[model samples]
Target: MFTAESSFTGDFKLVPLKWAERARKSYPLESTSTAKAVNYGMYTPESMWNKCTYVISELLNECLVGSWVFAISPTAADLSTIASWISDILVDSASLVLVVLEWFQVLSAWEKTFGMPVLTRQDSEVTYSIVPAKCYWTVFAHAGASWQAKHVELVTQLREKVAIRKAAAANKQKRPEDDEDDDEVDARLHKARKRPQKNENKMQTILPTEKAKAAQQVEQPEEEEAVDICSDDSDDGYIYSDEDYSE
Candidate 1:
């Protein structure tokens, strides 16, 4: 997102060399031949400084927006404070919610991608909170709590197929007499998975159900083709974005 080239305009390729030459030319000659000349050059152009400041401000704004969204605790007081902060920022008063939401208009889009920004009503007081993007485990647990026996059984079956296979393979080289067929090993694994009584109530489903996957597909259809975000097509280690923000 950010690049070094964005800090300057025009032919800045020779700026460093030019600055060195200027420093040498401007240096005052000392009368004593043995005296060491230590010239500190502060020769940055005004345009370069302004460009750098703009880039820094933009980066800070993005960071503020991201951190505020992710790190804030889910609380009414915090929500109210942030809302007021946003209001102040919109009026050019700057209360640290650094995003220019008017420019990108991606706040609501992000909410859709993550989850609903939850609102709670307690008596006469109404409070709002943003659910974190990576709360899938919490969401699934809440959903799976009221699941029917059929759904629970289905999820359990679909959940740990890979783990089961891995355990089977690992145990295959154990003792000659202990060696067992895949079916036997699988059955053993299923029995072993059920042995942990503490998590019996908790749904063990990490992956989504087939029906849910299908529903998601229907809701958000895939693009015709994948679009690469990198500016350059080369497979070199360096990545370049289109939003270089050059002056």
Candidate 2:
């Protein structure tokens, strides 16, 4: 669950989802306010192991039945039943444990995905017992038994990666260097989340168009008055009559 909590200092931090969300959000242009940066998953070293325990407990019943069936007939354990039984699964840790504990050829594909086992003593037992190192989460995380044997060195690298992811999640929650404003950061995130307006009220900018071309019209012919040759007696060199010249 994406749970939230507050400390005595009145500062609140979110959990589990926080880690995953924060890691993803840390990318460029993908960030929100870091004021509450500590909220990421509470995946501390101790808690990681405990989380694994929870995962084991949930799969405990299915693993037992499936393992036993596999011991008898490898194909007898139905994966559908395993899927229906488990709710949440993380990492391939628990499946590896059963592989190490017994060299039984069982399908751990189910565990490649779920979470926890609780510490409960047998009804007849008088005291609580600590889980053995062999039963530790690290040992389980390394459980990658397949139809074929893994090289002795390959297991070491796989376990290292599991440990690194847990550690990375744990450390990523520490207050980052950015001391950004909480309110502004929240506002920015809220703005980013909102769907863009289909019709923004912004006044459309009308771009200037090319200048219109000069218009063309027919030119009317002007009437040319006839010059009378006989009117040369006038003070002017030529005398014009109102009548126009004939073709």
Candidate 3:
């Protein structure tokens, strides 16, 4: 069960109720504003308030049963404050002023149960409470065993959804990095295939093959000239005989 105070402060926005005239004509309600006021007043009426309480209690019981079933079948529990709040609201309808007030208590209970801090306006005076964690889980375990199979199925589905979402996010994050690596590899391959081969061909062409051959031929003539000059040189002016030259 839950208890909460209503501190929601805001101006009401009037919606033009269609069939306002027809409804008034049939029901003798004085005006649309009167009808609205009467409807609002019903929650505060003692008899009507008890009926509302009963309904809220039933809802809370159902949430507890469902939550218990869900919690025990799986090792994991829903730490979501919303789920806790729903459970609390079901049990504590007597304390809720309006549906909105009920929601606030449920949220507060959830936060408190999960060790989360509550956020409130500086001027607001809202607070909530529920059973502690160990007792809560123990109660859930006791109640949940009967509905274990269904609870397991529900939790499995939820976990699968979470896993799928996480995987999709990981893939989304990795896609760009993969693309960047591919671009770099492609750029390197393209440079290797296109640019380096052309440079190698240009290098081959630039080598001085013709000039080297020409230089070799010119050096051969110089060497022959030096040999002839050496042979002709002598202190005496007389030429050697053919036999002496052969020797």
Candidate 4:
């Protein structure tokens, strides 16, 4: 049995209740604040507590018997009887609490035996007990720890595969409008890419014509200058220039 005590510094401690103290008085009888904190089976009568212990013992017996029977029989255990016993235990609030606390103790014992640290708080750091490295390592690798690690890895991989399957299924279930939207996007991209090539081809076709027109304009101006030079030479060659001016 555990008793809670608060120190002057406001720290809480769980002290084991002495047999005298545990048996001195029956579970809290009054509706006081302290009494309210205690659960139904926590400080109850010895008979009630013993009943809970007996139920646990019976469960262990069932497991032992079932294991032996399973070696010879195809049906390993009487699942109905086991389930009935569990239901009977859980029906009583005190019995349920006892089972939970007992399970916690079992876990603590296993952790101690396996050199694993018992977690006491939500934010507690998990570290191994001080033991030989090789010994603990061998125990952990060979025991259920390795199997649990592999199980977690497999579960993670299964979740990833499930997510991938869901995404693929969603993609496959696309609406016709979605497909149309995708096609429209592809067409727009194709057009955008082709526009620059079309402009380049147009420039290629237009450039030679523009160059020919420019060359024609330049040659026309040069031909006009040559004709003016020829006419001036012919007038110089004519000897009636002075007589023409007098007339």
Candidate 5:
């Protein structure tokens, strides 16, 4: 978990506005005019917004140890926007800390109220701190025009990946309607096996015992059948007489 205070050093070395003003006065008028023209009077503000942005960005890039970064341009709207962006990043970082704190609080409350341990050991506690120097370096790297767009694209890719993962997890929890279709197919197969067939050949073949019993009960007289058989038989046990019977 990360906290705003822990993610950024509370002790930032900010140069006073008076010092910047004094420094600006020391520069030649021609240089001052050129800088002013190029930066839209970025150096004049009493809040030292441009100076803070430059310092913070440089520090973040140089240190490379923390998440704090001055992302806004020095020529941006005003001190308010810079302050707001910094505050927003701090709040975002702090929210992660708050979440972990809330989770622990909930666990503690559960343990006290229900008399059951929610966590096994206090040794598993996590600690957070800002790596001020590294954080400054990271911010400085993005100060370049090309790097800013790259950073935006990287952040977008990360967000998209997270969304895809969340969707996959949600899909894993859902039961699709195909299961019901499978059940219906099984029921139909069971019903088909139980139902009687309309075709005579199919029905007769299926019920062999009934067909055999019916055939046995239909008896023919042996004496009448024997006389017909004897009249039909010829010398060589042929049913029809031929012109030649040598054998």
Candidate 6:
């Protein structure tokens, strides 16, 4: 439902485009050179960027109102900048749960999204945690048996939501064949319909029951004509023939 023209409004469009254009300073896309040389041009990236925007917007729109997961696997030039643009667009949305994975390596602020710090170093090794929603983000951040148990439980619940979303998406993308196994379903239905049945006999009934047609053919009693018994010029008074009833 989210089209490029309708999804972004006022500042939503302006801010992201501004950020994407600004990121050209670091990322250096091909469009940047054209815009700089022309001195007046829109610094829009390739069409692929628009597709990415559409998908992200659609997922976030769903996530804002419904239970869904909006994931971003950033692998391109200026990823941090792209991350910031994503943050700006999602900043105003309520109930937004963001998860960041520093798969390549942790940037300066890779440990957080929306300023909720989630990365920590435990025993001189890297570790990650989920900062639950509360007045205090560090409610369950402490390293203790109780805190660990609670964090695990909360993360498990979040994963369950993601799983539900995945399952729903899978079902939404399924084809008719996925639900049907019979190859002769259409053939059987066609054969069933083609079979002669008694239902149609009422329309084409046999001759004996066709009373309306028979009644129209039955002759009616004809009124008699007055005889010319006193005719002056008659040989046998009048003449009647078989042709008289032919009319």
* Candidate 1: Cα lDDT at 63: 23
lDDT of 1 at 220: 100
In the range 166-217, model 1's lDDT, one tens digit per residue, is 7899876667556556669989889888878536444445334666888888
Question: Which candidate, 2 or 5, would have the higher lDDT against the true structure?
Answer: 5
* Residue 126 lDDT in candidate 3: 34
Off by over 4 Å in 4: 1-175, 217-247
lDDT of 6 by residue, 74-187 (tens): 222232312211211111122222221212222456344476433333244422211122112235323344643454465456557777988998888858785474556877
- The runs of at least 3 residues in candidate 2 whose Cα sits more than 4 Å from the true structure, single-residue gaps closed, are 1-162, 171-209, 213-236, 243-247
Prediction 5 global C-alpha lDDT: 0.34
RMSD of 3: 18.9
Better structure of 1 and 5 per TM-score: 5
TM-score of 3: 0.23
What is the descending TM-score order?
6, 5, 4, 3, 2, 1
Write down the RMSD of candidate 5 (Cα, Å). Answer: 19.3
Model 2 worst lDDT run, 10 consecutive residues = 6-15
After superposition on all CA atoms, what RMSD does each candidate show versus the true structure? 46.0, 19.4, 18.9, 21.3, 19.3, 20.6
Candidate 5 lDDT tens digits, 1-247:
1323322322123324574365422222223212223232312222112112111232222212222333332333442211111211111111110000100112444466878645422255532211111122234333544542444354456556767988999887736687788789999998887665546667677799887777877874445434553375456666643434434
TM-score, every prediction:
0.15, 0.20, 0.23, 0.26, 0.27, 0.28
- Evaluate model 4: give its lDDT: 0.33
Error of 6 at 11 (Å): 26
The residue-by-residue lDDT of candidate 4 on 1-247, one tens digit each, is 1222311111112223566675322232222222222132223232221112112131123211112111111111331111101111111212121221101111243365768644342234321111110112222333432433443344356556767988998989979999999999999999999999999999999999999999989888543434342245554575445567688
lDDT of 4 at 121: 23
Best by lDDT: 3
lDDT of 2 by residue, 60-158 (tens): 332321222111111222311111111112222222221211112223344423532222222534221111112223333233332112322344455
Ranking of all candidate structures by their lDDT, best first: 3, 6, 5, 4, 1, 2
Q: Which one is best on TM-score?
A: 6
